[model samples]
Target: MESTSCEKNNVVDALTAVEMLAALEQYRAELSEKDRVIADLRSRLEILEGVNHELQLQLGRFHDVLKPLTVQLTHNLQLSAGRHEQYALPTGGARLKRLAISAEPVDVGLQHTPAKKVPKNDV
Candidate 1:
């Protein structure tokens, strides 16, 4: 009788090592892809932040441009509301007045004049 023993123990270890290496490689690849995505997102965020900052600056400029108009409108509203005594212009109001489009006053229709009544005899 002849006894034959299979020595495939090393083969199993080698196969397991190869599979582990392949899994590690795949994991590395996935991590690199995630890193790239994160970097791309970061860059996009930066660009959006810059655009937001620019928009904010533009909005501020627009506000600055419209400040005089706003103040004038507020003053007009106050005048219309008969709050002329309460409404006082800021120091910059002088400059805004100089930039006024027209020196003509705007009528809010609050003035009233009494009409004299004459008695007439019945005909």
Candidate 2:
């Protein structure tokens, strides 16, 4: 009987060990799945960061291109205004001189004559 009891206890211990090992394997599998999910998320974040950096670089390039154009446009406007003033000054002076010359008075004498009018109803 004693040997039989010892054998039964051994069998129970072996079975319990197998059950514990199976539970540990399940927990390990869950942990591995979580690690894989975290890795995928990290990869996606890295891609997004790269894209954002590229966009910022492109924006800077656009600003660089626009800056020269704005400066050129301002320079052209100033040059055009200077030319307009240079050309207009002589014409304005000439116009003023002509106006002064033409404004001199010219006089003409009027001759007076008396005229008689007949009434339409009498005619």
Candidate 3:
């Protein structure tokens, strides 16, 4: 009877050890899956950060290229505004004053004149 009891206890201990090993293997597989997910997320984040940095650089270059054009357009607009203001006034008074000071008589000319014939024998 003593020998039978010892054999039964040994069998139970062996079964418990097998269960523990199976549990350990399952835990290792879950940990590996979590690690793979973390690595993929990290890689994606790095790619996005690089793209964002490139976009910022491109935007800065665009602003630099447009800066001179914007300044030239503003200067041209100011000059045009000054010219418009000059032409907006009338020159009739100055013209009348100049005509009053002239001693020569004004003559009206014909709008269209007849064409004169050229002699072909002169060539």
Candidate order (lDDT): 1, 2, 3
Please give the lDDT score at residue 79 for candidate 2: 83
Poorest lDDT segment (10 consecutive residues) of candidate 3? 90-99
Q: What TM-score goes with each of the models?
A: 0.64, 0.47, 0.49
lDDT of 1 by residue, 1-123 (tens): 122223366667789999999999999999999999999999999999999999999998998889888887877888899874442576553543333475443554623444457768632
Full-model lDDT, candidate 1? 0.76
Q: Which numbered prediction scores highest in lDDT against the true structure?
A: 1
Candidate 2: list runs displaced more than 4 Å. 65-123
Q: Rate the local accuracy (lDDT) of all candidates.
A: 0.76, 0.74, 0.73
Estimate, for each residue in 19-77, the C-alpha lDDT of model 3 and write its tens digit: 99999999999999999999999999999999999999999889778866765565578
Query: lDDT at 46 for candidate 3?
Result: 100
Candidate 2: tens digits of C-alpha lDDT, residues 1-123 = 999999999999999999999999999999999999999999999999999999999999997788667655755786878743233322211331232354333443322333358899989
Q: Using TM-score as the measure, name the better of candidate 2 and candidate 3.
A: 3
- Report each candidate's C-alpha RMSD, comma-separated, in the order given: 14.2, 20.4, 19.2
